[model samples]
Structure formats: structure tokens, C-alpha cells
Target: MPFPFFGDDKSTIARLLSTLPQTGRVEWIGLRPARREQLLTVEEATAETDRHLTGDHARPKPGGKRQITLIQHEHLAAVAGFLGLAMPLAPGRLRRNVAISGLNLLALKNRQIQIGAEVVLEITGECHPCSRMEEELGPGGYNAMRGHGGLTARIVQGGMFRVGDEVRVLEKSSA
Candidate 1:
């Protein structure tokens, strides 16, 4: 479901894609203090409008599409299964900034999601797994995270969001 093709005309597939009524919850938040450095797990963080998270080292230019990274909590076990692990990998190990549960992040692509009450992020693209996954998760890690890598976003409206905050997709008119 590419976004550009879904306009006001309202096709059946477009309606289904836009009908994400289930709300998600923020399960974890991590900040990359520096590039390639271990992520610092936190209970809460502030998103700066048109910028990255307050403490995250990534300083993307204004309106940059990759300001934040998010992964699905459900995918943790899937990735672990692919690696033949008994336990799910920790959120920090994947290097994503936030871990969300209860909603399909893919469905939010090219849309805007409101985190908590104030933070709004535009789903820019998929957050593809990097080569570092091999070093971080041991051999075959990169391949294990291929499709489950998650999504990338740009901060649209900045505000504080905690680990337990609700995340919901905003309607096109609202976004």
C-alpha cells in the first residue's frame, strides 16, 4: 500500500489501511548517545519538533526523515526464533529508539502517529537493518533482522513521551 496512490478517492484497500483503530503502547525507549555506542535505555524522553530525541546523538537536519527509529515489540520473538534463540532479544540490542506493541508499524508508513498526548511523528520509511547487527547480535544477526528491522520517522510535533504512553495513528486531516 504505497501512500501516494491512496488519496481521497477511498478504495477498499485504502480504507482498510487507514482503519487502524487499535492503539499501541510504547514498551521501551533508547537513546544512542553516540554513533555505534551502546544505546541508553530510558523510561521517558522528549522529542524535539523537526529534530531527533533530546538525548539521542542523531542530529538530522530539520525535516530529516530519519529522526527516530521504532521497532515492533512482537518482532523481538520472531527475530529470536530466526536466530534459534530461546529468549527474545532485548530492545537495545536491535539499536532502535523505541519499541512499540499492539499495532503494525508498517501500516503507518507515510502517515503520522501521535505518541502520548503531544509527540507526533511522520512515518518516513522502513528502518532497514545495518551490518552492525552482525557484531551486536552475533553471526547471522543481520539476516535475522532483515524484514523485522522496523520503521524510521521524523518528529512532527515534539513533546514528552514515556514508556507506557499510548500511540495512535492520526487521521489525514488531523495530521
Candidate 2:
């Protein structure tokens, strides 16, 4: 079969992917900046944001507003290659809570991904590189993913997402 994970093939990622029995729900749905210990759906997260005043840094933090994100696994390897890191077998290098393969994350930027068992995530926008990336790599790491196409989205519904769980694009691509 044809493999679709991006970046340099890390043994860890390959091992993780191999552990998956089948490729049914090969995509991983996720949430970010969640300070609540666990991830929340978009509606709930948004409601919480509305309840708090702007710049309220009390509990949930201001940045944890509802959002969604998606990226093709293959693209992640491309990032390592671009960075010249020789990313081999490390699963978490992508920094994505859920690593999804077999889906066109780059093409589906700013779209919604629905999980049958739990919730729906509204694809907000691209998840850009930050200084943290530089910290992860050496110096020019951030420059590697300049335009690789990772998305940032809000969760519309709250639910549990696990590894190997199936994901369906419940909504059409917005852009």
C-alpha cells in the first residue's frame, strides 16, 4: 500500500502507525490551548469564552477559545526534511495531539472534522510556526514549515478523541 505521512520517516511514527490494525479512522481530531486539563467542544469552549471578559486570565486562559486544526501526516515528514533534521520514528515531532494520515490536511485547510464517537471540530485556520519551533529544532526549524499548510480550528462539539479513531469530514471544505 502507498504510505502518506509527511516528513522524514521516523521509526516511532512508523511503529505507531504499524500498530494500527486498519486505516478506517486514520485521521486524528484535536484541540489546542486548552487549559481545562481536557479538550472541549467548540460550542462549550466558545460559551465559556463569552462568559468571561476579554483579557480575563483567571482560569481557562484567554487563548483557549474554540478552534480546530488538521494536517496531513506526510507533510510532517516534509517539515523534517525541510529542516534537515532527519526526523526518524519520532511520533510527537509534529506537535499535533492527534497525528492523522490518509487525509488531505493541506487541501482541507479551514474545514470541519467530525468524529462519530465524540465531537466535531471546526477547522479555523492554519497552525503557524512559532519560536517554540526554534526551541524544538536548532535555529532555522521554524523556517522549514513556512508554507507547509497545517491548520488551526475550533471545536464545535466536545468529545473524546483517541488514537486510531475514525474521522469523517462532516462538513464540506470552506476554502
Candidate 3:
């Protein structure tokens, strides 16, 4: 049977998709200073409007869709479970720029979110697991991160964001 929310009305679906009230928190931040290097953990970072985060090696073109990457903090345990680990995986091991808790990152696709009081990011798409996952996570690492990889984003507004900052989706009018 189909979900009751999947009715013929398109507007209802749109409304449902837009109605995310939960606020997320930034649990961790990592910066890749260069390719093939381990990510460095930071308490805060600066995001550049329409560009990549400062101190991060990623040099995205203007208006690039992949200015930053984010993963669900809650998924760490899920990936660990897949790998038969006794503890949650460290956020840096995944190589994502940020690990967020509370809100569902997938639901933020195509939407803009404000991190803390300043920086704003537009959720672009999924951040697929690369072959490096196999090397970093071992054996089935790539497969383990298949559906739990994370989301890619483009910086919309720039500013300093710190760990423990609140992440909230901006309404269409505000975005």
C-alpha cells in the first residue's frame, strides 16, 4: 500500500517536504588541508560565500555545488554496525566536512540551512562514498557507506560556524 501522504495532490507533497521543524546541531568539523591527507578536526571554521570553507583544500569553482560535505552524526553508529564495530566510527574517518545531529540531512536537499548565526549553505546532493572508503574503513567500507554517505552543499552566505552550533532550515521566503 502506498503512503497516505502520497496522494494525488502535489501541493501537499511539497508542503510536507518543506515542513521540517527540527533543529540540528553541529557535532564535529573536519578540514582536509590537502588531498590524501587525514582530515584535521577543528572547533570552528569559516565558510566563504559561493566558495569552499577557509583552510579546506577544496578549491571549488564559483557557484560550485560541492563547496562542503556533511554527514549525519547518527549514521556513524549505523556504519559501525555494518562493519561489526563495537563503537561508533569517528567523524574524521569518513572525511566529511561536518557531522550533524538531530535533523535528517536527506530532507534538506535543495533547501538552504543556516549554521549558527551566520553561515548559510544550500544542500546540493548526495556525497557518494569514494574508493578511499575501502582504504580508510577497510574491506566493505565502500558498501557500508553506500546509503549512509552524506550530503554535499554550496555555501550561500559566509561566516564563522563552531561546533555545537544550531542548524536550522530556512523557509522558502527567507532562503
Instruction: Indicate which candidate wins on lDDT.
Output: 3
Count clashing residue pairs per candidate.
Answer: 0, 25, 0
For TM-score, the strongest prediction is 3
After superposition, the stretches of candidate 1 with alpha carbons farther than 4 Å from their true spots are 1-10
- Please give the ranking of all candidate structures by TM-score, highest first, separated by commas: 3, 1, 2
- Report the C-alpha displacement of residue 35, candidate 1, in angstroms: 1.4
Show model 3 residue runs off by greater than 4 Å. 1-6
In model 1, the worst 10-residue window by lDDT is 1-10
Please state the error at residue 63 of candidate 1 in Å.
1.0
Q: After superposition, how far is residue 29 of candidate 2 from its true place, in Å?
A: 8.3
Q: How close is candidate 2 to the true structure, as a TM-score?
A: 0.57
- For the record, the alpha-carbon RMSD of candidate 2 to the native fold, in angstroms, is 11.6
User: 1-175, model 1: which lDDT tens digit per residue?
Assistant: 7576555675757777778889999999999999989999999999999999999999999989999999999999999999999999999999999999999999899999999999999999999998999999899999999999999999999999999999998989843
When 2 and 3 are scored with lDDT, the better candidate is: 3
Q: In model 2, which runs have C-alpha deviations exceeding 4 angstroms?
A: 1-69, 88-91, 172-175
Q: CA lDDT of 129 in candidate 1?
A: 95
Q: What is the lDDT of candidate 1?
A: 0.94
Q: What is the lDDT of every predicted structure here?
A: 0.94, 0.51, 0.96
